[model samples]
Target: MLEKLRKLANILYWAATAVLIALPIAALGYLLAETPNPNRASALFPHIDIIASPTGLAFWSAFSAGALSFLLFIGFLWSLRGLFDFYRKGQILTLHAAGAILRLGKWLIALALVRFMTLPTQTLLLTSNNPDGHRQLAISISDHEVGFLLAAGLLTLIGWAMNEAVRISDENKAFV
Candidate 1:
């Protein structure tokens, strides 16, 4: 069982690492090719693709914000990689795993903030490009984002408890 877990972790670690590398390349591709205007962005994210409009003061702001958010997203994946690395070595309850999990919580919170900023902007962007129809402005948070935040909080609590347990075990072993 332990061996199987280790193997699975190893495979997951590699898979995540590949994604960490590939995602940016793909994002860059989107920026260079499929990206819409930068004035405002409508993401409906978590559920749909982003809609970017090039016709507002929000363009550069939205673009820059998206870039920063992407960085945070990458950081989240990197932290996951750390967790997987520890698990692959059968060190799931170690300090490294705890730290990685804590980092995941931070990233999740940051991601939620990014979503808040971009979601409203996306509504405008989605309608801005329509040649005849009046541009529409809309914004709403998705259930998915809320769920992600909740999961993040749970992971943080679990990791903190795991770290404390490991510390107690180490102290007990010291007396033995």
Candidate 2:
């Protein structure tokens, strides 16, 4: 069972590494293919003459939000690699594993926070160009964010327990 899990961890580690390599390339592709429309309505302004301009505030806002999200996802994958490495070594009860879990949880929390912030930001950026003044300031908690937070909490607790178990096991070893 441990060997199987170790194999799985190894597979996941390589998969994440591959994604880390691919993510930037994909984002660059999206940016290059992005076409800005100038005639779009604007709530922030009567008319945004720079819609056709890639350097415009509207363009940058969308681009920046997207890049921020992509970077956060990359952070998650990077953090996960640390945790998975231990699983691959069958050292799940080690301090390193616990630390990796903590790091991974932090990234999960950060990702959720980014998701929370991005919604309103994207709404404002996209609708700032709306001339109808009907721009939405949308904000809501989605199931995905909730799930991420829950997973983070569970992993943290598991890591803590693993650490305790390892400490007890080490004490037993010393007694022998």
- Report every candidate's CA lDDT: 0.73, 0.71
Clashing pairs in 1: 38-59, 39-59, 41-121, 41-122, 42-122
Residue pairs with backbone overlap in model 2: 41-129, 41-130, 42-129, 42-130, 42-131, 43-130
How many clashing pairs per prediction, in order? Answer: 5, 6
User: Candidate 2's residue-wise lDDT over 70-153, tens digit each?
Assistant: 788888888888778889999877878877787777777777788788767766676665556565567878798899888977
Write candidate 1's Cα lDDT for 1-176 as tens digits.
88898999999999999999899999888777755544324431323243434455545554565677789889989988888899999987677788778888878888877877775665465455555555556677689878987887888787788778888888988999
Can you give the lDDT of residue 56 in candidate 2? Answer: 59
TM-score of 1: 0.77
Candidate 2, number of clashes: 6
